[model samples]
Target chain A: MDRRKYLELFLNESREHLEGAGKQIEILISGGTGKNATLKEFYRNLHSLKGMCAAMEFRGLTELLHAMEELLEWGRAGNSSRLLKTVGTLETGLEEVGALLGLVENGDPDPSSRTGVLKNLRSRKKSRKIDHESRRPRNSGGPSEKPEVSFPSSIRVQMESLDRLLESTAEVVIHRLRLQRSLPPASGGPPGNHQENLRQSIDRLRAEVMEIRLVPFGSIAGRLRDAALDLAKRREKRIEMEILGTEISIDRSTLERLLDPLFHLIRNCVDHGIEPRQERLRAGKKSVGRLLLLVTRIGSELRVELRDDGRGIDPALLKDRAVEGGWLTPQAADRLGKEEILRLVTLPGVSTHREPDEVSGRGVGMDVVATRIRALGGTLDIDSWPGRGTAFRMQFPLTLAILDSLLVQGKSGTYVFPLHQIESIQEVPVGELERGRNRCLRWKGAPNVDLYSLDEILGVGENPHRKGTCPVLFLRTDGSRRGLLVGSILGRRDLVLRPLGSPLETMREFSGAAILDDGGIALLLNARTLLPETPGPH
Target chain B: MTKNVLIVDDTRFIRTMLRDLLQSSGRYRIAAEATNGREAVDQYKSVAPDLVLMDIVMPEMDGIQATVEILREDPSATIVMCSAMGQEALVVEAIHAGAKDFILKPFTEERILTVLRKVLIPQAASPKGSSN
Candidate 1:
C-alpha cells in the first residue's frame, strides 16, 4: 500500500485523538482528583496515539506521547502536584506535535525535530521520579473500582459523498416536478395516482438524505467543555458549565464552522462575564459562578443561547467607552438606549477588561465573532441587565445548502425571500399606500409597517405600480417588522442555494442565487439588510 | 495449507501495513482486522484464526485482557504480543496472560518472520529464534 494515500486519514484521525487526550488532560488538571479510571483511559489514548505516530515514522511525536503516558501513570499513583506541573509541558508538547504533523503532511517528514520537547519531557520525568522515590514511604491504598470503556459504533464517510447524495436527491425532485408538469389533465386515471405516489416517495427520500448531514450538537459541545475547564483553571475561577440540548442536531459543516466563534464566546464568559470568587461572595452570591449554554429549535432555525450569571455589562460604562474611543459622539452616546449601548461591546477594540490577560484579552475583539456568525447567515443579539446577568442569543438556519423561500417577481427579475423572515403576505390597495420619508402601510388598526420597493432596493429601477392593488410581504425579525412590495407573488419553493462568486459576492443586498424551475437564476434577498433601522410608532 | 491470521491494533495505518506484509509473504492468509481489543476478542471468536498478532495497549481493553479471555476459551490459541520500546513490564504481563511469543514494534521484516517461524513452524525453526 502507498503510504502517501493514507496521509490525510492519518492526519485527521491523529488530530482528533490528540484533541480528546488534551481535553482529558484539561479535566484532570482542573481538580479531577486523578481517578484511576480516568487516568487509565487517558493513558490508553496516548498509548494508541504513540503507536500511530510510530507507524507514520513521526519519531518526535511518538516520543512526546510516550512521555505523556509516563506522566499519566504517575498521576494515577496519586501524585497530583507533580501531575499539575507536567500539564503545561504536555500542552506545549501537544502543540509541537500538531505543527510537526502539518510539516509531515507537506512532504517533509522531519523525524529529528522537537528535540527540545523530548529533552524537556525526559528531565521532567527523571526529576519527578526522584521525588516520587523519596516520598514513597508515605504512599498508601489503590483504586478499588475500574470504569468500563465503551466506544460508539461509527464509520468515517467522505463529505463529498454526502454532498453528492444530497445533490442527486435534489435533481430527482426537480426532474419529478418537470414530469408532473408535463402530464396532461388527468380524468380520474391511474397514471395521475402513480405520479402523485412517485412525488411523495421522492420527497421522503430527499428528506432522509438531508437528515444524513445532521450531526448531534454534542460532537462540538464536548470539546467546548474541555476548553471551558482549561480557561477556568488558568483564570483561577470556579465556574459550573451547564450545557443543555446536546441531543439536538445541526448541519455538520455548520457545526464545524461554529467552533471558533463558540470558542471565543466561552472564553469571554470565563474571563469577563463570570465574576471572581471574592467578588461574587461580596455581592451576596454563590462563590462558584454559573454559565449556561442552551440550544433550542425554533421553527426552521436553531437558537443557541449562552447565559452567564455574573455581573452584567454596565450600560453606562459601555456608553463612556464608546464616547472615549470616538466610536460615537458624547451626545450620540447619550441618545442611545441601554440595549443599544450594550451592543457596543461587540465593536472592534471594545473590551471591558482593565488589563490584558493571558487567556481572553489577546487583543482579538468580539467583532470577529459577530462578523463570523453573520457570514453564516445568522444573527447575534445581546441582552444584559446591570446586576443580573448577560445572555447572547444566536439564531442560524438549519442548513446553508437548502432553504424554504417565498418566490416573488420584481420589475426586473424574480427574487427569493427566506420563508422564516416573512410573517404574512397581504394585498393593500395602491390608493391606500402612504408615502413620506419612508413608505408606510397601515392595515386593520395595526401599527404602520415601513415599506420598501424590492425592485428599488435591489437597484432594479422603480417598480411599476399595479393599477388597483399591490402585494406586500410582512417581514418580521426579532427587533422590528416591515413590509416589502413586489410586482407579483409566485408562491413558495424549496431552493438549493448556490453562493455568488467574485464580483457578485460584493452585493450586500443579495445573500446568494437560487435556480428556478424554469432554469433562471433568482437572487435571494437579505431581509436583514432591507429592514428599516428603527421601528415606527404605532 | 496457508496459515490464517488476525491482526489487532487501534491504528488503521499499522493494521494496513501489517496486512500488506503478511499477505505478500504468501504463507499467511489475512482473516480479519480489529481496531480495539474488544473488537479483537469478538473477531477472534468469529474468525478463529490459526494465529493472532495483538498490540499491547488499546482502548476499551488492552491486549493482555483480550489474550486472557481468548486463551480461557481455547487454551491452544497461538498469540504473539506486539509491543513498543520501553514497555517491557507490559510484555511480561501479556506473556503471563498466555501470549505465545512477543515482538517489539519498528521491527524489521526478518525479525517478524523469524518470530512467526518460531511460534508457528516450531520443529523447522532454529533454536536461535528463541533468544528473546
Candidate 2:
C-alpha cells in the first residue's frame, strides 16, 4: 500500500483525534465526569495518534505521543493522585505536538527529534516521583512504578514473525546468488528482464528486512553518556563527552554486543586517556578534556571512533614496556611501525597505565576489547600522537548474521575463515618456510614469526600436504601476523553463520557453522583456538 | 465463498484503511463496521461475521469488554483485536477476554491480510485442527 497516499487522511484524522484528546484532558483535569472511561478515552486518542505517526515514520511525533500515553498511565491504577500534577505537563506536551504537526504539514525539517519536549516531560515525571516518595514512606506499596530511564522502551512487536521472515528471506537470497553464479546470462528476452527485475526486488526486500532489524544509535547513546559522566565525576576529571551520530541506526544484536566494549572504551577514555586539569595546562592543551564518541555509517559497516584529547601514549615507553613484559624482544619492538607501536597497549601483558586503577583495571582487560570487536566481525585500530590524544577506531559490520568469509580446503574438510581476521593470503614454495636453529620460522613479512599447520593443528586428515608450493593465510593477531599453512584456498562467499549448540559447542576449534550457498555447512575455524597464545619468538 | 470480517474502530481513517485492505485481498468481505464496543457487540450478534477486527480502546465500551460480551453469546466467535503501540497491556487483557488473535497498527496491507487469513482460513479449511 502507498502510505504516502493516506498522508492527508492521517493528518486530518490525527488533528481531529488530538483535538478531542485536548478536550478530554480538560474534562478529566476539571473533574467533570470523574469517571475512569474519560481517562481511557483521553489515553486512547493519544495512543492511536502515536501508532499512526510511528507507521508514518514520524519519529518526533511518535515519541511525544508515547510520553503522553505513559504520563496518562500514572493516573490509571495505583497512581491516580498524581494526575493533577501531570495535567499541566500533558497540556504543554500536546501544544508542542501541535506545533510539530504544523511543521510536518509545511514540509519543514522535523523539529520533534531535536526538541526538549520529551526531556521536560521526563523531568516532571522525576519530580512527581520525588513528590510521591516524600509523601509515602520508603518501600511502602511493594514497588509501585519503574523509574523512567530517560529513554524509549523497546517493544519488539511480532519479534518471532519478523525473525522468521528474515531467515526465509536469507534462503531466497542465497538461492538467487547460487543460481546467478551457476547460470549463464540470458540474452535478449523477457526471461532476462524478468530475472533482472526479480534480482532488484529481492535486493530491495533484503535491505528492508535489515533496515527493520536496526535500532537508532540513540537508544544506547543515553547509557554510554551516563556511564562517561558518572566515571568523570568520580575521577574528578573535568571533561565534556560528546556523542555524534545518535540518529544512525544499527542491528539490535550488534548494539547489544557493542554496549560493554563501548563502556570499557569510554571508561578508559575518562580514567586514563584524559589528562588531569593541571597536566593538560602544562601540555598546552585545553584543561577540560574532550572525549568524543563519533559514529558514522561507511557502506555496510559502522565506524565508531572513541577519541580523547589528552595525554597520548608514548610509543617509546610502550615499546619499552613490551620488552619488559616479555611480550616482545627489544629488536622486535624497535622494528615496529608507528601504528604497530600504539597497538602494544592492547596486548594483555603491556599496559600504558603505570598503575592499574579502581575504575578500569579489574575484571575487563584492554585485550578483551580487540577480541570482542573481532568476534563481532569488526576491526579495532589504535592511533595515538604523544602529548596530543588517542583515538580507538573500531569498524563493526552492519549485520554479523551474514558474514563475508573465506572457504578454505583443509585436510579434514572445507573450513570457513572470517575475512576480518585474515590478512594477505600468500602462495609460497615450501622452501620459503625456514625454521631457524632457535625454532622460530622466518617468512618474507617478518624475519621471525610463528608458523602453524592446519593439518597438524586441526587434525583434519591422515595425509599432510607436502612437496609443491603451499598457500599460506596470514592472520593479524594483536599487532603481529600469524602465518597458517593450509591445504588450498577455495573461494570466498557471504555466509549465514549459526552458533554451534549442544555437544558441538564443546569443540573449541570451531566457533560456529557457516551455511554455504549450496545448503552445505562448513565449520568456522575459531582464530583464538587456531593460534593459541604463546610467548613470541623475539 | 469469501469469509466475512467485521471491522471495529472509533477512528474513521483506521476503519477505512482496514476495509480497503480486506477488499483488495479478494478473499475476505466486510460484513459490517462499528465505531465502538457497544455497536461492535450488537453488529456481531446481527451480522454474525466469520471474524472480528477489534480496536482495544474506544469511548462508550472498550474492545476487551466487547470481546467478552460477544464470546459470552457465541463462544465460537473468531475475534482478532486490533492493537496499537503502547496498547500491549490491553492487548494481553483482550486475549484473556478470549480474543483469538491480534494484529498491530498502523496497518500494513500484507500484515493485515496475513493476520486475518491466519485466523479465518485455517478454520474454514480444516475444522479438525481448530482444537484450540
Candidate 3:
C-alpha cells in the first residue's frame, strides 16, 4: 500500500469510528444493560474499526478491537453481568488503542508493547467463557444474531472541495456587485428590475453555497460528553452535563478550530469549576454538579455559553493574584469593578488554582481560550457570582468568509467596523468633548461613553477635514460603551474579509482587510483593541 | 484484451493499493471503485467488470452479502474476497456466498497477482510460474 497517499483518510476514518464507539461506551456505562440496541451498534463500529486497523497493519489496535469484539459477543449472548464488570477494562483497552493510533498518526508505527494488553484480554475471555459454560451447562451458546442496519444517507466530502466551492461563490457575488455598480442608475421608477432580480438570485445562490460548509454542533457534542465523563470519572466527582442548541450549525472550519478551546474549558470546569462532593454538600448544593453548554445563533453571530454550577471565581482573589503577579498594580487592581476583576483571569499565566495539577494548571490557562476566540474574530466574556456559578460566554462570527461592516472614512484611510459592535452613530458638538487628559464625550443618552478620534488611535496625526461637528460612533466592548470619532459614514456593506499577511498582521489595530464595491481596500478595525484602557485616574 | 476490475473496500487506502497494484501490472483497468457493499453491487451492475476484489467488513453491507446479491443477479460474476487474519469465519461465509477466491490483506503484489491469475486465467496459468 502507498500509505502516504491515503494516510489522512485512514486516520480520519479510524478517529470517527473510535469516537463513535467511545460515545457508545459512555452511554452503555451510564444507561446500563437496557440499551441493547446501542450495544449492537457499538459492536459493529468496533468490528469495522478492527478491520481498518488490520488493513493498516496496526497490530496492537487490531488485537485490542478483536478482544473487545469477543467480549461484546459474550455480552450480547446474555452475560450482561460479566460485561458490566469488564466495561472499565474495555474502556482502558480502547484508550490504549487510541494512544497507539495517535502514535501511528505521528509517523511511529511500532506496536511492540501490546503483548501485555493482549494477554490480559485473552486470559479474561477464556476465564469468562469457562465460567459461563460451567454455570449453565445446556444454554451455553454463542451470541444471538441481529439484523444488519441500513446504510447511512450521508457521504464525506473533502473540506478542500467545499472551500473551493465557497471561494467561487464569493467571487461570483463580488463580480455581481461590481457589475451592478458599473450600470447606470434608473431615471425615475423602481430602479433596474432585471438587475434587482439577478442580484436576489445570486444572493440565494451564495447562501446555498455557504450552507454547504456548515456542520451541526451535535457532531462534536459527543466528544465533549466523553471528555466530561472521563474527567468526572477520574476525579471521583459526579457531573451532569446539559447540552443545549446542539442542532445549531456552525461553519466547519470554525467548528474544527473551536474544539481544542472548548475541550480546555470543559476540562477546566470539571477539574476546577466543580467542587468536590463533600465540598458541594457543605455549600448546600446537590451532590452532582451541573455543567451546561448552550449554543445559539443571533443573526450572523454564534454565541456559545458554557456554565458550571459550582464554586464560582472570586473577583477579589483574582485582583490580588494580578497584583501579586505584577500584571496590575495594587492601586489599579483596587480601581477595577467586579466584572473587570473577573476578566483578569484571562491574563496569561494567571491561574486561580493554588497548585498545578495534571489536568488544567500547567500554566496554559483561560488566557489561551480567550486568545483563540479573538483569533476567530470573536469575543469572550466571563461572568461569575462568587457563591453561585461561572459562565464563559463566547461570541463568534457565523462564518469567517464575509462580514457585515459599517464603513467609515478616517484620516488615514477608509476603515470598516463590524456592524455588531457598533451601537449607534451621532453628531456630537466639538464644544461638548471633555478633553481633560483623556477624551470623553457625553452623548445625550450614554453619558459615560469615552470617545477617541480615529486618526489619533491609528497614529495618523489629525484629520484635515475635521469640522465643527464630530460624527461619533457609540461602540460596545466587553460590558462598557465607548465612542469612535471618524471623518464620515460611508454606509454599510457585506465585505469578503481577507487576512492581512506578514508584517501587517503584527498591527493589532486592524483585524483584516476587505475590498469595497469601488475596488478599493478598507482595513477592518478591531474595536476591542481600540477601547482605551479605562483612562487611568487622570 | 484488458480486463475490467471493480475494487471495493471501506478504507480508501486498501482500495487505492489494489487499484495501483492492478494498474501497474498492465493487465487490468479499474472499471469502478466503491466504498461499501451497496455501492459495490450497484457499480457491478453498471460496469459489469471481469473481476471484483471485495473487502468483507464494510458499512451498509459486507462483501459476503454483496457477493450473494451480485451472484443472484448474475451467477458467473467473479469475486475475490479480501480478508484480514482474524476474519476466517467471514471469509468462509463469503466463499459460500459465491466468491470465486479469497486474498488476505497486507498481501504482497505477487500474492495478489497469483490469486487473480488463478481465478481469471485458470487454464493457461499456474500459481508458481505466473509472475510476469
Evaluate every candidate with DockQ and list the scores: 0.26, 0.32, 0.25
By DockQ, rank the candidates, best first.
Answer: 2, 1, 3
Return the TM-score for each candidate structure. Answer: 0.52, 0.48, 0.53
Top-scoring candidate (DockQ): 2
lDDT of 2: 0.75
Candidate 2's docking class is acceptable
| lDDT per residue (tens digit) for residues A1-538 in model 2 | 7666667887899999889889987887787875577777778788778877765667778878887888667646436556765766677678778888888888853446334445545544442322221122123211123333233323334556667878998888788768876778867344564576567678778788888888999999889989998898898888888999999999887888899899999998888889888899998888898989999987667989999998788888889988988988999988788877887877886776787688798324677777667666566788997778899998866786766789998877889987876878887677666654323455665555676777767655421455677888888755666778888888877677776765665455766787777777798886645564553455
Backbone atom clashes (below 3 Å) for every candidate? 0, 1, 0
lDDT of 2 at A486: 84
Docking tier of model 3: it is acceptable
Q: Native contacts retained by model 2, as a fraction?
A: 0.50
CAPRI class assigned to model 1: acceptable
Q: Candidate 1: which pairs clash?
A: none
What is the C-alpha local distance difference test score of each model? 0.74, 0.75, 0.76
Residue A293 lDDT, candidate 2, scale 0-100: 91
Q: Native-contact fraction for each model?
A: 0.45, 0.50, 0.45
Q: What does the lDDT read for residue B120 in candidate 2?
A: 65
Q: lDDT by residue for model 3 over A323-429, one digit each (tens)?
A: 88889899998878876888888888776778889888744668878777766777778899776899999887888887778999987789999998888888877
Give the runs in model 2 whose Cα sits over 4 Å from its true position.
A29-37, A76-81, A108-116, A127-457, A460-538, B127-132
